[model samples]
Target: MNSGIGPMVKSQSSIPLYAIILILCLIAIIGGYFLSKKYPLNTNELKAIFEKEDGESNDITEPSGDIGNSYAAIDSSGVESGEHGHYATPLSQVNKHNIDEVFHVAGELVDYDTADQVCKQYGARLASYDELLHAYQHGAEWCNYGWSQNQTAYYPTQKKTWERLQYGKTELEKTMCGVPGLNGGRFKKNMKFNVNCFGKRPDKPDTDFVHPKLPKKPTKEQSKEELKHFDDLVVIPYNRKRWSRKDYEPHPV
Candidate 1:
């Protein structure tokens, strides 16, 4: 009987096929992993992760306040502090045109009429370059060397008083006073304050409720260029508002 158990000669090398298969499987797994990392399989899920992260960032969803859309300094209001102080409003936000009412506005081209209304609402006119200066200036008017403050420190806030103004003029005076004079209208609140404390409160400090600092007014020169414009239908920071001699020379428009 021929023994089938005798040493059998291997017909083919199983090592090559097995080794090649193992290598191919290892390569396939590694390649698959790398590809998955680069191009994920669950595309929607990956997209969702990115969307969630981006959506949560304030920079992405927050409105472009008076500040424009771009990296810039943040104001005390936690919005963008614009360049040249030309405020930026989000296209989606409601804006009252402030440019129109600024005794004389400068910096950016704005919807003057809308800005005018906005200013009126706040009892603030479009800040002429001079007026804007009040928000930041320290020391004497026209004293460029003097310390100036930022918006955060500029106004504590508009006063809660029935009359909220800065020039110390009564709200009635502001309403009644024609250009170049105090408001002298028939409104009871206006007429009453005009008689009682117009001169005493020549400077409006929001009735001392909100931000309480009365910024020194603009210099004379700044007043001429910035305020004179108001007399001509153009709004400007008035010169009478000037508080010091250093600001005697009118600033260039």
Candidate 2:
């Protein structure tokens, strides 16, 4: 029953298992080297990939310092652009008449016409009723009422809503007497109100980049000097002699 051809056929078909494994290892090494060269990985990227493979979130890792600093720089620039975020300051704190779109001019109460002219001189328009409300919501405080758009007037009070309620008045009732229950009160056109103007700050070239009006960042030495002469730097109120009140309270509508 034995056939001599059967043994010959079995011998020809047999191949070494070690040789097959060695060939496959070479192919894998060559492919991996080319892939790594084509798409290089950063430390963070590698870490993210490994973490993802391990069933963890890549967000667990914090951004590097350089990335964080870049974000900080963007935020600083956004403030100059008057973007509605952390950089927007209260109108009271705005010293420049038109530094960042919305700014106020503290002057003797002037009629609506005069306020319009004053704002015009600075290439700005009087803040509208909504604009005034926005400033109030953003924490602007001035005892002297300001001329708002559409022949209206507005001012911010330090009293919180609850405090006003305790005084038998609601904040809305106290805020906009002109609208009856809304935001602003109608005032005589001839009466004077401080002017708050809204517009874009002019852009100027800085080195190679164009930038809006920017407050200079003081150095360590400049900070010390400024702190030493803080009082000298502050301008006294124009009507301080006539208006002896240091804390200006909101007047009744």
Candidate 3:
């Protein structure tokens, strides 16, 4: 009973609680490294995670080079480029032959402003005097007096029909639609008349210069009202049959 050791004391853990926690964290980190090596995140996923951590927007759009080049080409084309949904023609590319091509839109005795709007609706503009003359020289024949630029009206005809002759009998009519001139006569801006439209026709045609559809014809009642302005003897047929296939109705310029 008198031994030097009194009783065996229980042994305590040599590692502290903090050191044990550190060892567990190292094991978890090593396992995660292996898992990441087996299944790595894609670029988009990584970017999303980084964006979320940085509190940045995830919406990122790359610039388009083709779209930029297309705009540049349009700028260099020397055309009236469309803006805000309004289209126009490329006048710089127009040639002499294009000047000789014209179309007509019979008005219900509309004034210059109305006539201009009608032409624009059909994707065209008022023809110039020289353009009307060139068109006349190229066998463009219309029996209706149409409003042109410079507050003038003109009608081109190859034959001296009774319809034209009736108006030619008067002194003023002779001066308006007579020989030795381009068949153009000045008029008041408020005077009602038809419309002579000139379309854009480039020397080298392309899809950029597409022709617009023709406007709808007036109804029978509308035509009757229009007929009241002109005598029956001088009424010209306002139908598609009267227009030639050669006439141009291009997009607005």
Candidate 4:
């Protein structure tokens, strides 16, 4: 019993494996938090970089016919397709003063009243005949028939293609150019069609202007004189050698 070397006791200074691992994990977490605070992440910039690397684009090509109906769908920002054919930027971002711009508002066919209301909802009005024609000259083309001012429906075409000709010749001679009036016959008020909206939305109601007094109806003789004057100023000059013999004779509206 003199050589007593009883049971050995465990060392109290040594740390447990589990405890050491937990401390290291805490340190890593703290370091990561500080690093994130110093360098914030930009999702947009990252997306742009990834898109660039992938050769992806946000620009959409111009679609044709009914297949292009998606062009009329409005985004959350309240904009459809952009100027001409590209569908990249929201129209709200474009210059409001550019009168040449034309926007197709309705993807589905709608009556004249609905079309007008739809355009108004967009803070625009039905495009005028002259405005549509000017837009066509400036490279605006849409296959769908659209409601225009004066209760007319017109669809712009770059050329007189057979598909376009199926709508019919605007003139008797069939040689007229530019935006031809739809030959499907006189447009009915309830007839459904697309809407072409023009102009920027007014910031406020126009209260400064007063309505002009209505003009008195002219007598039959006065009407005839006015008709002759109109023929001289507009009809004759416009028709010249272009219109047919039937066009020279006045037809009842």
| Best-fitting candidate, scored by TM-score | 4
Give the Å error, residue 185, model 2.
Answer: 0.7
What range of 10 consecutive residues in model 4 has the weakest lDDT sum?
70-79
- Worst lDDT 10-window in candidate 3: 65-74
lDDT against the true structure, per candidate, is: 0.31, 0.50, 0.55, 0.53
Instruction: State the lDDT of candidate 4 residue by residue for 198-226, as single tens digits.
Output: 75522212222221121234568876765
TM-score of each: 0.18, 0.33, 0.34, 0.35
Error of 4 at 252 (Å): 30
lDDT: the better of candidates 3 and 4: 3
Q: Across residues 59-123, which tens digit of lDDT does each residue of candidate 3 receive?
A: 86431111111111111121233221112223443343323246665425688877888666645
Q: Per-residue lDDT of 81-183 in model 2, one digit per residue for the tens?
A: 3222222233334244233344455535689878887677656788786665554454443334667788887654333332332322345434322221223
Candidate 3: which pairs clash? none
Scored by Cα lDDT, where does model 4 land?
0.53
Give RMSD (Å) of candidate 4 vs. truth: 24.6
The deviation in Å at residue 142 for candidate 4 is 0.8
